[model samples]
Target: MKRLKQIVNELKLTQAAPEAALMREFIFYSPKMPLRLHQEQLVAASKQFSLEVFDTYFAHSDVTINCFSWGNGKRKVLLAHGWASKALDFYELIIELLKIDDLEIIAFDAPGNGSSISEFSNLMLYAGSVKSIALNYAQPDVLIGHSLGGMANVIALQELEITPHLLISIAPLIRLKENFEQSLDSVNIGAKHQDLFFDNFAKEFPVSASHFNLTNLYQLSTAIDHFLAFDPADHISPYSFLKEFLDKYPAIKSKSFEDVGHYKILRSLEVIDDVVKRIYALPML
Candidate 1:
């Protein structure tokens, strides 16, 4: 078994460079569906909440938005997804919050996930997408995001003036350390197995094997390629980018989940409920 593992690692190392390049491109393209099983589960959970969905275009990419229009509610809460995840990932939380007729909940599949255009070639592009969405949608009373979504929210909030009453960051990937950068550079899906990269991570991680399945393995591969190409350290620089954001907005309040990894943060029902209650409890502008 150990020998087999060694061989697999060697093979992956052998093809890392080419795969990383390909992965980078995939991130810029959009994601499609039959969708993942987890995605479907979230969608079904959201459906119970009387949420209405809207399809729009931004940066030449298609974007699908799901929102529950709370009657006479001026405040909007925008939920964002993480890397390699679709907007529907928030469906579990949406279902719970939509019960509060006073809270208008809005969530979107980021450019590459679900019904949104997938063209996040860089952080700036992602920030632009978020800005466009916020400007076009109801101004957010609060913005809540998990992992990559949180980073994107910071960028959008910094670049655009659509300030939310509060920000909730769940296991946010604030910055990629230099070590993590090199480690991510190690992921390799050869030409033949490229389609397995994105789906593989879900399977290998905490997600139940029965829960997550890709709609189109090809599209999943494309998404993985795009994500792998990025120098995460450069985009959401902890030293520079985050520092700049904090300097500009010194009092922006945020809550973080320390124990959860990138994706699992949203999978937990408890975490979702806690985040909702916290957001609801915060003082309004």
Candidate 2:
């Protein structure tokens, strides 16, 4: 991916037509990384608990997206995984959520991730996919999203007409422009290239950088119960971001863990229990 970005940077310097195309490709392309043996085992084990597992496809913008679901319960729960992650990343959560007799679990590999065919996807695409799935495929009574997925869920709630009775975000990415800047800095991309990237990104996404924020969206009035869980040690999606949200929505139930970072938080027993407790505690809607 860094090489691709470097190529895009070189192409941008020339202002060539293919430069835009390559930039788009770089933005959209999500390379599939092989899971470790333990990770594969976790996914395999999670599948065992599924009463049923099936694939479904949906259209987001011009792309067709593939999604997978497990369990068979009247009350539906939609799980959204983070960037470069598959539905199986939420395996631990799926196992715990299944404890609820009437709860079904639906999860999808966002475009460019997992089994989805699209080469690239952005936060807007992720949010649109979530909204499309909720409206057409399954209406979720409970929505749980982790990291980038959590950010997508927040955007979905803001733009979509339907709202889940309960919403849970685990280590959500906030501060859109800042995150983008951080990403560019980490890659050592030049300031000129960063400007070009954001320009292209804005054109493709069609949303102002100012609008791509959870802090701004969370301020809107909503009766849906919100739960946020984060660890201060999370370096990717800083705990400070979560802190900003908590400060604004003090009514939101929250949990802070010291040991777990971004990825492992999904698998932590304490986090799972807290998530389950929130869902089970929700009055049937």
Candidate 3:
């Protein structure tokens, strides 16, 4: 059964590249199909949290960004969400950090995802979306990001010329190593064939996408949906998104974890607490 699954997955990859991109957009861009999180959980968790969520324009691009703060303070903490995810995705962790009376939390949805704009065509456009958001809320003592968000933050900081006192990245895509980079545009393993990735990993490698739940699958599907509009074939490989974005290399330092796919990396309470401690420990200026 496993061998047969692998064969089927490979065949799908071989056949899907040309049209898979279009099909992906059809699934993701519907106004009725926008991705959402558990609203009650987000709202109930945020009471007395001094939350201010709104949309603002940055460089004329409408950005959906939120600010959560407690008490008056000069310090600002900005949280960036991963690809295809919204600012609310960080609500759970943001609530935890809001307990600190002297701190502020802000998060934003990147372009082409969530309530933000729906049309961005390249890595620079994605990074610029971050820059536009950052300019509106630049009072940062620290910057936190997960996976694609982390990478975008790096690019945004450079583009906006904004610097935070501390930078923390969780499972960031600073580099993809060699094998994953090589596989990006491979005729047999391109990004367009991600629907078959689970089966491919299960049968070809020892990994199974089933280890994750429906939420994870939904987010992955969202990412595929957005990538479809970009016509990834025009670019070298999806790998170049990171390479091109990182060419200048911002000064922030970071730590990464394995075994945690992008979404799981942001869901860690440990990371949230660690970030709070680091921000609080910074010297008052």
Candidate 4:
């Protein structure tokens, strides 16, 4: 309250205006983690596997994206990193993929994430970046995504020129609108500013709030296998909500682990093994 009032007073702006400004700032970033602290990890991981870095133009902006690739197998596996994370964050997972004789691994950082350059980012921008990366690379035979990256890969299934043979989603965002609203509430903005913020949000995004979720957008062309791995105890992407969402589609194959949290699920050897096995299990397309 004090900081909000101070900003409002200093700028001679209404309380709602400052809250709206804050809402815009938070809405773009609340769901994603920042990667500055992980710089050393990215640097050291880049040294392994003789990574090949390339650039692509993100679909939503005039920004260049950093893409990573390794392995020399005929089958291409594309890895999409979540917001605020880079391609090398999956160093362990990449190591497992490298072991496969027939797999060529590909991964990329979305604009403003990792080595990619951009001033800011949003879900739509990230999704657009995913689409751009898929088309730039040879269409991937296997697609893997984590968190926001998982959601982006799902969106890729809809937007890509060709559908992948296998899709793996790890704790994707179930309903981004609900999460965004909760983020708004956390900032202690009153209802009026919230309304104003959303009104402008709709104008800027030009899409229904309901459209950004995983449920309504989740689909793959026939013959595509899907795997989902997530810890039900995850607080970031709540297990109960994921359960209800999963319950609606019983055919989807899933594995549950407890206490690994949202991000560590990526690092879990069990997850890496199962994911590798599934990729090998995928019928060559």
Instruction: Please say which candidate is ahead in lDDT: 1 or 3.
Output: 1
Descending-TM-score candidate ranking? 2, 4, 1, 3
Instruction: Tell me the deviation in Å of residue 270 in model 3.
Output: 2.6
What is the TM-score of candidate 4? 0.81
Using lDDT as the yardstick, the better of models 2 and 3 is 2
Best by lDDT: 2
Candidates 1 and 4, the one with greater lDDT:
4
Provide the clash count, candidate 1: 11
Clashes of each: 11, 1, 0, 0
lDDT ranking, best first: 2, 4, 1, 3
TM-score of 3: 0.55
Tell me the lDDT of model 4 at 85. Answer: 76
lDDT of candidate 2 over 1-285, digit per residue (tens) = 565557657655554333545544554466565667765665554432111112222233366566666677778898988887878778778777777878878887777676666646677767867887876777888889998899988788777766678889898888777776675565455577667777866675566565777877764345768888898998888878778878887888788888999889999999999889888887765
Model 4 has an lDDT value of 0.70
lDDT by candidate, in order shown: 0.50, 0.73, 0.47, 0.70
TM-scores of the candidates in the order shown? 0.57, 0.81, 0.55, 0.81
lDDT (Cα) of model 2: 0.73
Error of 3 at 110 (Å): 1.5
At residue 230, give the lDDT of candidate 4: 93
